[model samples]
Target: MAGLQRELTLRFLAEPADVNFGGKVHGGAVMKWIDLAGYACAAAWSGKYCITAYAGGIRFVQPIHVGNIVEVSAKVIYTGRSSMHLGVDVKAGDPKESTRSLTTHCVLVMVAVDSNGKPTEIPEWVPTSEIDIEMRDSAIRLMDMRKKIGAEMEAHIHP
Candidate 1:
């Protein structure tokens, strides 16, 4: 696996439409944001269009309540021939109350595919800074989590 500093970070103001009956942002909505950020990070890192091949280890660590501003950050961690590992984290804050917490975190695996939907080689990952090391470690851990979850999912399907 290689490394790249490509990332996408976005801030969104939580609204009623983003939350559920429990008054927290819907898990699916969080996942949608993760997917978008992950894919965009991968595409930017590889300089090619990318599609998500898998999502795993999606954990809701805290609840993002309505009226909070949520910040999402994502980046590419690992790259194979045509595949990448992405990490996404969601944090919630209030402009007035000064509260910030990690609401969710997820691991995304994406593949670079050509116009014909065939997998294509990714660009070379060049890491020249300390931040790259942290990203590499994060990617490794995220990949391990993905593998474990994938195994469990497979067992559920096959068993």
Candidate 2:
């Protein structure tokens, strides 16, 4: 809507407990942050509770070390009747540094839900900037790819 927020940012420090055997932040930890950020953005945009329907194109571009400041940013790029597509980016850097590099990126689809947990209608998201338009188009393209993949998987399973 006119005054609604479409984006969210979460910042936290990577802790020792979040590290994996490789001495870097675990992939699962980053994924959880992505989901949390996406959900917050989706719920804010829809003004309702939301649940994650899909998450895809997860890319780990760099490693996050313990004590690094991690920032997860999420924005709504597109919307269906009950679903919102979120583009999420995770960045990490040393606490004493001034720059953070992108560590992970993903797109997630979250569906607004009612009190009974059924899908509920959500306000449409309109792209107002060039970047917003491009991101929305990208989300649409990914959705199309997912449909084709799902169809192929279904065919193989049935055959």
Candidate 3:
């Protein structure tokens, strides 16, 4: 791994179709982009076809306007058997400057399945550097948050 590989990058110019009446990009549009980017990242790392099994915390802190271009990037965080966690970051940029500001971040858990739709094992994640370690740690925290959120939802829905 001398050459660091980019998993997936999607640039979307905030269009009227992709925005709300307020002229800001719709949350769902951002989700669609994140889903594609995350799936691609997981598939590249797993070296197999993948499906998103779960979506973690997605916070849209700032509104991206119609003229701004949003770019999404992702990388694999952890893997266990058929499950892989992919970290995604979304940034808003201006055409004048390719530089982007991080606007959203989340973790997506995906599963690799076989032709029969059964879960399939994938290569384990290996942290080669400090950045890798931080990625894994962040994934772990996100995973725990997902569990907590599930518990909260269950308390409201089932209890």
Candidate 4:
């Protein structure tokens, strides 16, 4: 199956209510938007309900101010038997401005689920474009790093 639909972009205006005491948009708010965009992309690709299994490397590069126009983009970069890995990027800038700066980025792992909440396999996605291939390869490399990190973390925990 063609997987070109496994990408999504969402845009919203950051209002006063979205800002913290510092007058910058809250990190949690941006994270919520990221999750929503990732979920939408995964669901569209899998054609099934999905749940976020993990979110890694969340980096807030810049603060998003109130009244800034926010854009969240999510794309499927890799997939397992039942899980889809997504790369999400968030950007914000003045609505009238021609340029937007990246505010945050993260990778999310989402697993397709059935009505019983059990993980289910979805169609495999093969990268057709040069950019898609590059992204998929990057995701594979990151997944290897994630595994090593998880192993180290587990070794230190004695629970």
Quote model 3's TM-score.
0.86
lDDT of 1 at 9: 90
Return the TM-score for candidate 4, rounded to 2 decimals. 0.93
Clashing pairs in 4: none
- Candidate 1: stretches off by over 4 Å: 1-5, 97-99, 127-131, 134-159
TM-score, cand. 2 vs. native: 0.96
Q: Residue-wise lDDT of candidate 1 within 1-159, one digit each (tens)?
A: 223447879887888998888878898888988888887788878877889998887899988888888888987766778998777898888957676789998878899988998999987565557887787777777677767987999988999
Question: Model 2, poorest ten-residue lDDT window?
Answer: 1-10
> What would the per-residue lDDT of candidate 2 be over residues 1-159, giving only the tens digit for each residue?
521999989999999999999999999999999999998899889989999999999999999999999999999999999999999999999989989999999999999999999999999888999999999999999999999999999988999
Supply every candidate's count of residue pairs whose N, Cα or C atoms clash at under 3 angstroms: 0, 0, 0, 0
Question: 41-158 in candidate 3: lDDT tens per residue?
Answer: 8777777778989987787878887889888998877777788888889999796896889888888898988888888888777787899888888888877888898899998998
Once fitted onto the true fold, the runs of candidate 3 whose alpha carbons sit more than 4 angstroms away are 1-6
How much does each candidate deviate from the true structure in C-alpha RMSD?
3.5, 1.4, 2.8, 1.7
Judging by lDDT against the true structure, name the best candidate.
2
Worst 10 residues of 1 by lDDT: 1-10
lDDT of 4 by residue, 2-102 (tens): 35588889998998888887888998899899999999999999999999999999999999999999999999999999999999999999999979999
- Candidate 3 lDDT (Cα, 0 to 1): 0.81
TM-score top scorer = 2
